[model samples]
Target chain A: MGRTLTEKVLGRKAGKDVRAGEVVSVSPDYVLSHDNSAAIIKEFRKLGVGRVRAPEKIVIVLDHIVPAADEKYAQNHKSIREFVAEQGIPNFFDINAGVCHQVLPEQGFALPGLVIVGSDSHTPSYGALGAFAAGIGRTETACVWATGEIWLRVPETMRIDLGGRFRAGVFAKDLSLKLIGDRGAEMANYKAVEFAGPAAGELDIGSRLTLANMSAEMGAKNGYFAPDEKAFEWLEGRARRPFAAVASDPDASYESVLACDLDTLEPQVACPHTVDNVKPVAAVAGKPVHQVLIGTCTNGRLEDLEAAARILRGRKVHPSVRVLVVPASWQVYREALASGALAALVEAGCVILNSGCGPCLGAHEGLLAAGEVCVSTSNRNFRGRMGHRDSEIYLVSPATAAATAATGKLTDPREFS
Target chain B: MSRGAVWKYGDDVNTDVIFPGRYTYQIMAPEEMARHALEDLDPAFAKGVKPGDVVVAGKNFGCGSSREQAAACLKAAGVQAVVAKSFARIYFRNAINLGLAVLQSEEAAGALDTGDAVDLDLARGEIRSAKGTFRFLPLPASVLGIIEAGGLIEYTKKRLEREQE
Candidate 1:
């Protein structure tokens, strides 16, 4: 009879008690779109609507392909600006901002007990703050922008309790890869995953964000971690409004319960062609790594960058390995620069990119040629994810990535220190 | 009811292959996207596609990333529907929102192979192929409503008119 966090939050938004498998309509707190806003705007125009129904509930971010890769991309950006100007929409973050998911929480658009939808899959990144967020298509986003309301069939809940403490060199990324590997990507399809237990609470907001961010790769509708004092501390003055904390009842409905023991887990990697194709770092050790990328929406936070910097400092990158570092947002980028993390990375022969989704999506920045192997901290390792189908990508933690760059092979980070 | 030849894909056929990340930078229209639909996975998909064709695949069709362009490209490639063992949550919703039909039927996915002829009765939630006839759960009424309205654009347009009224 108890309710899950997904049920509790969605029921409140729907103005009634809801259950799994029942379709309900509700107004979300905010809807987000990034560079894809250009595509969304085009679709909105096709609907023959003159203005956005609720501009305030919509936040637009221009991070992908910033500075416009070419005239086509530049034209897309131009139209987005025109749309924002005509609609007088606030909360429009230009190219200098960061990824949409990061910018939303950073600027206070993401708050506990709220429902947020975005045009990007990693929208669940906000769930670390106790908000219910998920990715929707551009057309669905257009609908949310038009009416501020969306419909959903409350997904079943998959409760994963991360218990025990993490050993040295083990991180949220390793745990995430472990979960995906163990459960497989589609095990939680059409389901919301709620993280609980001691280890989940002990994680910093950044690490929690990493877990929430990779929920997309696990095929989760969204990922939730109960908002406790740590989340409140992170949102101190940044939360848009005062929100009553919400949590699932102790006996809440769950499709299944999984206990992820961090004490026994080791550094993990998702090998070429599939995220769930996970392997322990030692299994793939000594494989040649031509490039090492240590930043992305999933792992481009201050903690991740700082970890990579600490490992790479006073050590030159392997001559054959190309290292690239990209901060998730302008704020993170500035903070990393101010704190000298960027300097350490640069001195170690890493190419520091602007605060944009660079090679993660394989949009020309840091692309891999045929037969090349890259050790990346980004989420996916699908074939052709980084460019040529023959090229390969190995997903790793930032520490392992930095260590790999230094040695030009899949080396564990703990060995370096 | 409709009949079409199927182009089969394996399990976990991700969005990256259906629409490569290399093209993410190019802001192209749906039709433009169709030109390269599944080019990375099949290489012959776009040029070989015909209107009313269907894509049959194993488990987890259209997994990875929230890009709606994957569904849009398939729709633009004249794919009438996609039948699979299962689907990633976002891809399933995106397909419905973009006016592309998708269904989950383990039997259909397991029996059908590339170039097989399929008789699909979408209204009745049945797929008849050379192997056999299999049934799938019909999409919920709400999703059917959006599909009948020709996707979210038209659905939202009607909603806007009612709001004004």
Candidate 2:
């Protein structure tokens, strides 16, 4: 009768023992929103609250359509700035900060043993740090801002145990794509997924974030890895506050358990229109691509940039393909610059955009045209996601994206390495 | 009883198609968003849908992204409710928070077809059509309370007023 990590976390927040299917009201340590803050502001106004209950608990980052794509967006940004200043909300990142998912962890807000909610579905990306983070709607977020409380149903836990080591040219993105493909997009709907086992432990923080970030694609309420030495080491200097890690009990109950062996895993790609329409890179190799995007909250970390750089060093991109490199945050951008990864990418004819979510959600920067195909390191391949409805997106790892950009087609990363 | 014509779709009808991400930042007004609802998935949906029409789809309806516009647009466009085999977690919450009725019934999703006339009884959790009738689990009282109040904003306002009283 042991409790899972989710049960333990919710129990602490609820001030009582809770079980799956039970709804409890609790105040989250942080509630995040980005460009959608404009809409949230509207909803908050409708609530007629003079001021937010707890401004410190709210985090706003402007990365969706950074620097204002047009007059309308600029007005929205202006309103947000005014609202942030008036409400005395301390945590606010403007256009230069980068994607909210990366900026939250980089600023040390995503701590273990805390509850966090955001207005974006990928808000669960923070669960990689062992926090119980889930995505909520803008209206719910506005309510949280007004009252400082929100209700959540304790979710059933799904345990995914990853074993064995990944071969060269295969990465966390490949494993993530494989899992979604095998289980389909709705595999973990409304459930919490805990990644465990040897391979999960061996993955670096960046890889863990990639897995947790893509968990949204599987419709998971949240996805997380137990905080271990690696997680603690990553948070050592970055974490703003001290936190105690949470872990599941030895006999914690799980709705189901899935065992994934990484030994034979290969580079994988999600084809046009859906994230779960995945195949081995070899199966779809030689499909012509017009663009290659190598950054976003999904694969826009320093390690991902270095992975692409290793492949693109001293090599020019295919003349027909336009390669765009975006860092996840200013911190990652600076680190890549210092490490010469940016130089390698730039020298290889890649367009290095600023640190933000560039073209991942099709808000701005690097949108595809009709009949164009893009090999992207970012997550989500839904139709009309990046640009024209006729344009297609192929989701791949950074190594695979780089290889595809170099060849102007969907090429396996193994060919480059 | 609430009745509407069904607009049928298949599995994984994601938010990107329901309300394209390209308009996520550009459009703010709910009415404006209504113009783009399902424009990518089905161009005729926005123009043809009446105020009481319902959307029927297979598994994972409203999947992808946490944009409330996906539900808000449909609601603005006069979508009475959405019937699906299942729903993505965040979108389910978004739909309720926006006061949009969302029902999950494998029976209803499989039985309903495009252009079918259907009637829904919220009080009894029954969906009746010419083909037959399907029952879905009744929503929890707490969720019903939110919808009854029109949305979370009104619910919160009432709660705040009660606290002050």
Candidate 3:
């Protein structure tokens, strides 16, 4: 029977021909755990799962409660650390290792034509590498721990094609914001979004990852770009096994189709309260900004840091505007620090934050005060999402955010350079 | 058991508010967390809610976050059914996984109001209120089976047990 990526991955994992809308037991090539719910070790203990069904499939990382803020957070990490030690899980990254999504593909745990599941929503970020990844609950994670398999319903595919070259200073972040604004967040719920056409092919793997990572913000099951030579180059040094190059057949049908020309695109921003409340940057130009953040698993890659560093290289952040920079992972951090990006940001008076979610989830640092305005490259601008319920968040590309940080007002990157 | 009392909510009542971001790190005491359900939107929600009530909301409900705490809070609050115009995919699965009953009805989301007494029939996908009877889009057999068996875990357990037999 013919199948889509979701069905193909699930079927191969299950050792059977999995069908859409049918429940089938399928093993996952990779399973991920984070500190937020590692406490489920107790639940696994009660479930009587003996030593995890497949230890090699387990990929655990310490992310959510990083650096162990307190005794409780410390215990959360301790629980997972003990479980990983006892079970002999093959892939375990401590807090220094970085956010699971960033480091997973970085170290080559995620590959094309595989199935991966994490205990966090952004697990879909791995879709950029052409894998099927989704977030599941703790009990489901426990079940996966018991049996490296899960049941899945193959989702219909949605095709979004872009064919033109982007305008100056327009980044993938702006393109994604344009998408979410045009279609609304739930437009592609429970569906796969495949990117194609000239513009997508021209984008580097890092930018593609930024686009795929935020698919969750729009409620997509996963977003994928077919495996390219660059992907092979990325895997050459890391992975041991052969990977299949997966893409839709030339004539593949889509449940829906959306097309945009990159040449006509503009730098966009998501207005306060909703990721979907999007508008072109020109509409909100000159708006006051209290803060600007240039990071998150979404845009915290080396390219993102380089973009911000380039804009802030010879300038200081406005005294009234606080700017925070967080690399997606420690690897990115060390690379930036070595390449002078970190020093440039520090010299510009930007707060260099740790490589965790921070401010993105409002759990750790960088919460906005009442009525304060922030321009960030992070996904999701939901109300009070960054901290104060009344505080407003503006979502922009990394370049725009850096430029805005230096100016203390919403400004486009093109205007400065 | 009779379908319990129904509580109503407006549309787009995202997963973040159902279970705030601050509490995701501590998910063991889901019931205690329920005390703050919708507290961001309605400060008195925890006090106003009673067991077996239903929550009805507008379109694109459960829009953000995949935290199971959202469903866990609804389950802890003893919410019997959630009828909305639509649900975000992960939240839908999480609610079903946690044994919380959720239904979809564009009309029900439009007509229902807070404090209105509602009786929901899971099998029929019908909502009966003093104002009138409203029909909902029927649940697929799979989702119906999940709800009947008390959620995904229980459903999976039942399947596993039956397969063994």
Candidate 4:
């Protein structure tokens, strides 16, 4: 009866041997709240508490609405800034910081073998480095603010084994969309997914970040890939703490096991209105689009920019198409600029925005108009996720997004390759 | 505690439709969010829903962002509870923490229809709608304690006060 990675991490925090199907109160190593900190602060005040239980352990980031979209958002940011200053939360990343997922790790707050929770759903993005991260609501976060602890039901583990080699231009985004397309709503509900097998090792930390971040779309509580050399390599100079590397047992029990052969997977896309409404690029090709967005927490890393630049080099964006490239973090943006990736993109007529969650949550920047069609690399494509509920969104990899921007339609990356 | 009625929906009712992201910036209060509850999915849901009305849906209700507004809007819109075949993990926690009753019963979820009369006994994990009588698994005792305490806020407030005492 070996313990799964989730069981071991949670059980260690709970100070007892635990398993799936049990609810236990566990103190988290790190808790995060973003621009929603404004709303969370409102609830925290109502909890009748004068001070936070563990202010030092909490992180507050401002990436949702930078420079404040309007007066209301500006006020929200102002409120959060005041809360952070008043509460004396040491780990505070303001507007210029970038997305909390990237910032948390870059700033060395997220660590392996820790239980991390955030107010936003994609907080599981930290699991790319083997942390047990999940999302909670603002009110629940308020409770954590007051008490410094939360009770979470240990979720059953779902093992997704990725094997075989990936074809060129078929990155982790394609594999993630295919997995959700084949088994979305039911398989991952209330379950934590452990991505195993050789293919999991094949992906770099950036690709792993994309896979873990979109695990939210599968209804997963969290998704994990065990810490390995790649994880250490990425965290080399950034991580401040010496973490105990954790991995699942060789014979750990799982609720279900799914297999995906990377060799056969193709460039994928999630159609408008649903994360699970996925399709292969060839299946729905030739649909004209008005815009192409090439960044977000999911695919806004330096490697993602490099991949897009590879496809966009010496090619101009279609006259009818609008392409926007946003890096995930300031670090990534700086590196992309230093590495000439930004130059290639700029030469290709792509507009490079600041490093933030641009146009993903529809907070601001690159918003779509009514009836416009957008090919994006963000996580969700729900109605009005960008700007107009009537606008259409197609989820694709950066390679495909760059290819589509060149053609002004849903073009396959292999065609450009 | 009382007999109720249902408003049915099909599978995968996402949070975007439940509480659109467009309102994330504009609306802050629960009542303000309630005004647009399910507006895209059904324009009249906010106005049509009455207090003590139960929402029944198929698989994966509240399946989108970690927006508490999805559950808060429904709670403010007078949805007594939500009974679905299943729920997204994050949404399930949000709904419960917001003090909105949520039950998972495949039999009850598939059986109910729009405008169907229903009755519930949350303590006993029992449901009686126009479709039939069905049973759902009761939440853990600890979870029930939070719900009984009127959600996380009330529960935490009690703990804080008792610790002070």
Interface RMSD of each: 1.1, 0.9, 2.1, 1.4
DockQ of candidate 3 is 0.50
TM-score of model 1 relative to the true fold? Answer: 0.98
**Candidate 2, pairs of clashing residues:** none
- Give model 1's docking category: high
Name the regions of candidate 1 deviating beyond 4 angstroms: none
Worst 10 residues of 2 chain A by lDDT: A241-250
lDDT minimum window of 10 residues, candidate 3 chain A: A42-51
- Reference interface contacts recovered per candidate: 0.91, 0.94, 0.29, 0.77
Q: Model 1, A80-176: lDDT tens per residue? A: 9999999989879888887777788888888889999888888988999999998888888887777778998898999888888888787899999
Per-residue lDDT for A1-417 in model 3, tens only?
Answer: 356676677667778865555666677888887875465576566544367778998888887657877777787888878888898987888888777888898888889988888777778888787888888777678767875667677777887888888778998998899999998888778887887777787888888898888888778878888778777777788664677756666655578788888988989999977888999998999999998988887899999999999999979999999999989899999999999999999999999988877678777677888889989888877776777778888999999999999899999899877
- Note each model's CA RMSD in angstroms: 1.2, 0.9, 2.1, 1.3
Candidate with top lDDT is 2
- Give one digit per residue, the lDDT tens place, for model 1 in B12-75: 9999999997886577777999997997799899999888889999888999888888998999
iRMSD value for model 1: 1.1
Tens-place lDDT per residue, model 4, A32-115, is 998888888888999898999999889988887775788998888888888888888888888888888889888877778989
Q: Tell me which of candidates 1 and 4 scores higher on DockQ.
A: 1
DockQ (CA atoms), all models:
0.84, 0.89, 0.50, 0.74
lDDT of 2 by residue, A45-116 (tens): 998779999999999999998879899999999999999999999999999999999999999999999899
- Of 2 and 4, the candidate ranking higher by TM-score: 2
